[model samples]
Target: MNDSSSGRTRDPSPAAEDPDLVRARAGDDAAFGRLVAPLRRELHVHCYRMLGSVHDADDALQEALLRAWRGVGRHTGRGSLRSWLYAIATRTCLDAATTRRRRALPVDLGPASDRVPPDGVARTEVAWLGPYPDIAITTGPLGPHARYEQREAVELAFVAALQHLPGNQRAALLLFDVLGYSVAEIAAMMDTSTTSVNSALARARRMVAERVPPATQQQTLREIGDDRLRRLVTAFAAAFERRDVDALVALLAEDVTWSMPPLAQWYAGLDAVADFATEVPLGSCPSWRSLPTSANGQPAVAFYLGEDRTGTHHGWSVTVLTLRGDRVAGITSFVGEDHFVRFALPVSVGGETAVGRCS
Candidate 1:
């Protein structure tokens, strides 16, 4: 099998010599499964990038694989199976994108609140951009020429920016830039002219550049190094567990912003965020238990809220921190019990020896 970064054009059916390919084309279901297994993980990532939700990616990938299986005989062995599968997956996501609402974060809904309100209402009408469990994300770029690493491509900023794009532009940008497909190859895969592909790519690049950060979280993390980065994340979770507002504030950058999806209100600037932190997680919430984790290639904390009489701490939010240098620059707390399962975290932390604990 060719590496994902391998260029598009090659000898027809490089895998044609494999018996499995012959069996798959000739209608062996097990053979088809063997052919698809290796490419499945990356394909799922591609779908997630396109749809901006893990649930949506799951649905799209299932449909794409089924379609590929049904059309296996017609594959003609003219291109690599991986590229063929990606084309199916990309189109599947596009079709889903047309009918579904685009995912968003709280910041997208309105201007930042200057101070904390008594409470913020959950906006169920908005489809929030959910976090990806970085454990499942591959570490490197899909291709050598790909601009974004696999983890960087899934960073909150990058995926959130993708949600703003129109379907064609989104597909073009992901295919050409993130997946490193040549314009001519993308044109063929997308069933469009090379000129059309180039135009779409140009437009997509401009819009994405406007929203995604100049420095990705991946680059920042590399500079921080593992030991210091781990300590910074540990300190962050500890502050919340101890309800130490001062410690938490100290970890934040001067212009730090805090946002929680499902909550339409967001806090920006040090004072505004500190005010909200002082009022909410540090105040209104009686107690918090935290477990250090990672998401979107950034350090994160999985919080469990107020314990029951039985001493079970219920799951709360997966808070992902975006670092600028060694300080926390942005905090995105994806608040919902539903998020925990994706990270393989239990819904409640019983009286266990988890990393961060306070009462």
Candidate 2:
């Protein structure tokens, strides 16, 4: 559980000379960069998990670095530099969370067709769910000393579920349980008693567990390769282009669930979801296209539709599909133009299409 195995090691003695640190503390830019470089990616991930949004993580990380640079001269070497940075980052995140409410997807809001606030209203005002970088998954295996255990725990569902907990509770649980910080360490980081940290952790865990459904046994749909995933995307495009509800339904599981966040409504079962699709505005919008992408450790499609006048394509939802065997278990569509760029999806589907605008 030491720092080296955890991927948080500092430079060896001569390389990490006291004089170099002293110079860095006195405002040497190159020396300071060396000190901060090792911790950047891990700190970003930590902030993402704590804030539940990539954008927020970026902000918090910058703030933490600035704070560290400004205060570096006061470094008494009382503790590990990694821990110290984490303490600063954790406080920054807590401050941000305290000012803003938590974010949730449709499932967290409630059942299907529930009366909810308008999109970009109170829901967005409360923290909105955010995207994560795929590189976080491809990183090498974590050691026993790694701060965060179970990287999948930062998946979209898990993060969306986290929005249900109060801010302090979320911070405490992430610091103690996910990050493997000692209870006393968490207390020190949050400036609370050890007993309070324990209580917050218990409450946060219970709340998150209650909100998120247990992971069911299903086919592993994550990173199945580009070719196979493109097939699914192609199938989806053809079905939607033809406005063929039956064809689309064929791709879904019997118990398939569909949801769109911010609106706070969801549909369960094939028939119910089919009815919603066929009856909604989706029925009218034809000439659909989907580009392949990944999110929440699952295969996903970023959708676009052809513009009638310019023949250009416009943005649509990024749908993360859960597969049971070969059938689709769930389809969660994250809609909005902003989400398209944030998730690094294309503005349009790239291919020639014979299908014209459907009447």
Candidate 3:
């Protein structure tokens, strides 16, 4: 293996990840960029899973790339490029986690509110989990040893569970089980003994198993079938457009929960959710346009609202729906127009009906 800092060429074999390794090692910025392009999205998502914030993932990934670029010459390619990048990313997140509080949801704070909190959510007191753009999360087996499916790993339930573990345990668990790195490889990544890595993995698995539900959203969606799923999301969107409370309630579970982030106020049970709908959102007399989409590996819809249906309905929020059986079990509405950028969703819905995956 060659160590660039030593001004040596000990890399006798072609263990390099790319054929252009020579150029990348010689400080050709474009070559390095080209070399890492294919892995960027996956790497970013990996950071998001570690830190639980889209914004923090952006910063961590940027820093990791900078570090990786300067040190690329030392990557003698003894292992896969993917694992190397992941090692850098995971360490970067571990560093960030020490400074910031573990990301959280309103449920983690207290019992559900019977009514929307009047004082409003204080952002400083809460570190809400930001939604990840679906574009960055791909579906398929990440590697032979991976346990969770790509989408299943990103679900809100799974990400929330990861937050409870210590930073090292979190990194060890994600690297070994979710990303498919072996115990020996994870030991190297975390700079710990293989026995220590196994210990962390065992503790992490126990905690995550206790918190995560028996059934994942991906499995639920699979059983629903694509056509039925589309029709269901489309119908929910239509009901919102019409503000038909009865139709909306019909799709909800009797114990449905509705939460709006940045507000810290969540409603539980059918009656409470229906009351909030009648008194707040639906009662506001705003016309809505919803485009169905997917988030956190579950069904979602993006809303745009306006005084009338003529020009454009400005971006409102993205609602992710959780299901139990065939009914919506919970609704998490991440409010604010700021969420549009990640989805490549327009700030406003114009002439045509709002378009996306139809969830």
Candidate 4:
């Protein structure tokens, strides 16, 4: 089967050979693992786009794999194994969406706040959008008619906009645009008519366009080149460490935005963001040390805050930067020390070092 995102035909899994298939069908765990292993990472990413949380995606993909494994015996081999697996994963995500609320950012809830609130924003009860650890993502259109690259679909802006869409609309859009599924195929997967699928796609496209920026992060990163990208990320991290608000401001676009998830407030524009820097992160928050990392396929810094007299530091937040041309256009800082656990980051730092060993 042709991978929609690439021109070359995808190699059939070694397990798809008759002998291996038979073994898997007969309930050999090792055979089954080989049968599905090739597709697991991509399928997990699909689940993430569908459901919007790493934990949720992990759970949904596991359930989908279980369902696929239990039902492997029924396969007639009329279709590509990849398509069949995707159908199951899509169904799994749809089920989860029906039961749980959509994930979102603070910006989705209300207008941008000029500065941080006195007590800080509430972190409990809200289903805030979580950052994705750096993972391989397919770039370029899935097919001749596709819209978003696999990685672009997961960018903070794109993902946030998607959360506002109704579940079915979101699914149809991802399958058709990101994964390059045909209209009829999507209808069949979603158990709807072709006409209905078309309508969903139309609405989903419009809503996403309305919410997302004109240029994607992927496009911007490519334009900037790798060496420059590294320098840019490092500069931001250095500025944060020094609490140099002006230096930070110098790197921002005229209308840059900064939002801290779980915090209802966000800052927009150079002046407002600078005000925020002076009063909040720079002024109120404790000492910081940041390590360069990537999240959602974009440059990010995981920050550690010094919390005690002994100079101990703990995971503070993961700040993902969004750029436009040569300047930073947006910053979404996902707060909460607990978040470090998800990224395999150290929970707390000490012993004459701190957040990822003093970096």
Winning model by lDDT: 1
Clashes of each: 1, 0, 0, 3
In angstroms, the error of model 3 at 323 is: 1.4
State residue 332's C-alpha deviation in candidate 1, in Å: 0.4
Q: How far is each candidate from the true structure, as Cα RMSD in Å?
A: 3.9, 5.1, 7.2, 3.7
lDDT of 3 by residue, 24-116 (tens): 889899988887887888888889999888899999999999989989989887676677788999998999999998998777878888765
By summed lDDT, the worst window of 10 consecutive residues in model 4 runs over: 1-10
Clashing pairs in 3: none
lDDT of 1 by residue, 1-359 (tens): 11345543331344556778789888899999998897788898889999999999999999999999999888877687878888899889989999999999988888999777766888899999999998878742354546666677888999999999998899998887777777777888889998998898889889888998888888898899999999999999989888899999999999999998888889989999888888878877767878988887788999998643236678889999999999999999998889999999888876643332221
Q: RMSD, model 2, all Cα superposed? A: 5.1
Q: Which portions of model 3 miss their true places by more than 4 Å? A: 1-14, 118-125, 139-141, 350-359
Q: What are the TM-scores, per candidate, against the unseen true structure?
A: 0.92, 0.79, 0.90, 0.90
Clashing pairs in 1: 5-143
Number of backbone clashes in candidate 2: 0
Over 227-330, each residue of candidate 2 has an lDDT whose tens digit, in order, gives 76667667866676677898889888899988765545688888888877786525656556667677756667777766442366667677777766567778
- Using lDDT as the yardstick, the better of models 1 and 2 is 1
Better by TM-score, candidate 4 or 2: 4
Clashing pairs in 4: 4-142, 5-142, 113-266
Q: Which 10-residue span in candidate 3 carries the lowest summed lDDT?
A: 1-10
From the highest TM-score down, the ranking of the candidates is: 1, 4, 3, 2
Predict model 3's lDDT versus the native.
Answer: 0.80
Angstrom error at residue 109, model 2: 3.1
